[model samples]
Target: MGCQCSKFWVCCWDSEQKGLVVEPPSVENEENSEADDLPAFHEYTIDQLRMATSGFAAENIVSEHGEKAPNVVYKGKLENQRRIAVKRFNKSAWPDARQFLEEARSVGQLRNHRLANLLGCCSEGDERLLVAEFMPNDTLAKHLFHWETQPMKWAMRLRVALYLAQALEYCTSKGRALYHDLNAYRIVFDDDGDPRLSCFGMMKNSRDGKSYSTNLAFTPPEYLRTGRVTPESVMYSFGTLLLDLLSGKHIPPSHALDLIRDRNIQMLTDSCLEGQFSSDDGTELVRLASRCLQYEPRERPNPKSLVAALIPLQKETEVPSHVLMGMPQSGATLPLSPLGEACLRMDLTAIHEILEKLGYKDDEGATTELSFQMWTNQMQETLNSKKKGDVAFRHKDFRAAIECYTQFIDVGTMVSPTVFARRSLCYLMSDMPQEALNDAVQAQVISPIWHIASYLQAVALSALGRENESEVTLKEGSVLEEKKNKTA
Candidate 1:
């Protein structure tokens, strides 16, 4: 009888028949369109869904809704006796309903071995429900920490790692999957103990529209600066997940640096595994994890490379049958000995070699100017430090050399004539004429006898619109050079 729009609900009545008629694109047409484009269900009355979920009883609630984007998930038995996980979208507090709807539709289309399948959806009036295949074993996070479940065997953990990497790779290959808001809580373990990537609520398409909160421990610094989520950023998150799986401890934002600095394998290894897993493999995993957590995203491996690196480890060792058989687990702690450390180093080197052989660096090479800039900056920082500071400032290192020289000036360290002259050359190499003049001025103050510095200073000042000063400096330097040459 009426059609609803943002402004108002409209109904038309025929005076002759005293009947009401509604004229708008039929609901059936709209529903069919939604179904054809993406899987969506006809609106079921809220009463019907409430009944299906046993009146939204607490007992039926499988998991508590998340705080960032809250939604109630209930284990419901439909009238047809099909059991499902009913995710009720919280429309009241959500800022953009249409955007959320678009995200749900896009994520619903992603079907991969590592991804959890979207079953269907229900959009009835103000109530929106997403129906997904129920993950029987709950999330990997819950499985890992739940007292009722056994510790995840090392092999399974590796499988999960590889699975996640492959999923990310698949999403990236499609060129549609932007950044996944990944974390332990989003990884669900099925009855087969295989991990499925879930929680597409935060998923974004290639169009850069989503704004999700950052998990500081798992998110890389680059992602923080630019909203761009590279495969490397996902790899970083996976690496953090690997560490969490090993240690059985929640990695805090504060401890991230310590984990990298200490490289303590024992600190991250899961106590539940009782050190039963191979110490060598554990150490290797930890090292990779640390690499993933590198402050620089470029240092981290891509998801595809990470998958390749982890998959072989599974082949190298036999899965402990007893652990899989559900044996009475024992308590034993594995210590990180020198051998474990060596093995980890070997594994990392092997990964590097494999990556080199694959022409990955050649094909992808620091091809992006941004990547090159980051590399140059890192080189500069290293050269500036006292320990490795003396490395030659080659043409390649000129950017870094200039940066160091500039910093030296800012700190009032240009006391020596030699230092000032060197800094002047560095500034010249960097195309900074004004900076060169300043350096040359300091050099002349220290020792005006430096004819080369004077000449360079004149050139710099000339470039900087100080023609008079430039001429004066050049004449003085020429006279001094002649005098010195005659004396020699």
Candidate 2:
């Protein structure tokens, strides 16, 4: 007699002589259809499911059992001694059973390293179930923002970014589906710390006429105005995801739907990662994100280009700024100014006369150690060279000044800001604005808050016809100096 059960199963039994015997379960004769056309799935009755979930015990539930997408996820052991996650889908809204089946089919066909694999599904009578590969690490969103968990490290963040980019490329190219929703919540990590893109319930085929729903914060601005899902739109969402990952903060609950609407991006960044991230790299990322959020869809970069732009950033933890210019050796001094020479050479015999003339002490102790003397000699030489260079500069003898400055620069003596600043000025006087700009930029990089150096840079930049950039440089220099003063 056939077993009175709707579930399909393979029967197994222990024989008296043999250890065990495998046989097919008998079922009532019904009109047969082409089984080859349908996807194969092992069926389980409600009673079998109950046994697997330990009588539907509350403890077996891995996630909350409520009315929502992915309603209930239960970690249970099947009768065959295999562990799996049983996702119970809410059938109240899915009035058409065939639509649910098609969704499952679409998900099953997607095979990607960065994406979660759909194992199988069950659609018998009113009960709907989806079985997927169990991921123990759960979602990226929880780990990133949860108060109890440790924050994601820099390396992990980069890895997540690379994995996400690969997954998006995969979906758009091979699967030919638009992952309309690519958010932190949809990313899950495996035991090995590899990220997997999940939650394709909102995915749509590229060929389908149906459009994706607009979640303004995560949606591209163009799509928000006109509901359409393109590959560029997916890239926009990915960019936002990158921001959230780096920030390590979730969208605020109050304005969750309109999180991306805000123009002041600094407010959206995570306070924890404030000083940890590189300013230059952060600026680049923010710039990319802004482009992604552009109102015109065509203005955004394609996925391939986006990935290419992020390549360099992914390898390095932080972009290094040129902080120190060429360091001259210590004890170096520039040539004495014309005023110094005239006063020293005039040398009045009377102490009173010397004091009145130069306003200086006549009996000041001079450095006498041999090493000190040698250092003084080097300083005198450098000063003489600088004086010669200055004379050349005054006569518009740029080549002579360049040669003198080059030799003085090679002496390994400490060149003060004024000296380098003057050398840069000579370069400017020679109509070599590019070279002058280079020197001034180097000086600024070495000491961004140096007022004289910054001013020189502004002048050089103006000469180069980059007035806007010059203004920005001046503003940055002012800000840097102010910040230093405040800190001091």
> TM-score of every model?
0.51, 0.48
Q: Which residue runs of candidate 2 sit more than 4 Å off their true CA positions?
A: 1-51, 55-57, 64-70, 79-82, 199-230, 251-266, 315-488
Per-residue error for 71 in candidate 1, Å, reads 2.1
Q: What is the Cα root-mean-square deviation between model 1 and the actual structure? A: 30.8
Q: Each candidate's lDDT (Cα)?
A: 0.55, 0.54
What is candidate 1's TM-score against the reference?
A: 0.51
Candidate of highest lDDT: 1
Model 2 scores a TM of 0.48
Q: How many Å off is the CA of 186 in candidate 2?
A: 1.1
Tell how far residue 197 is off in model 1, in angstroms. 1.3
What's the count of clashing pairs in each model shown? 3, 3
The 10 consecutive residues of candidate 1 with the worst lDDT sum are 7-16
lDDT (10s digit) by residue, model 1, range 1-488: 02122111011111112221122221111223222422333335566667556566665677776766466787654443344677776665334557656656676666555666565566556677766656655777775666474676666677777777666766666564455657787787654556777745335422334334546545666777886766676766776787767676668634854743454434555666764555455545655676677677677666555666666567324544234525322322133223222222323233223322432222122122333443576544533641221232433254565555555445442244544555565565567878877776655544535455556666676667767656555554565556656777
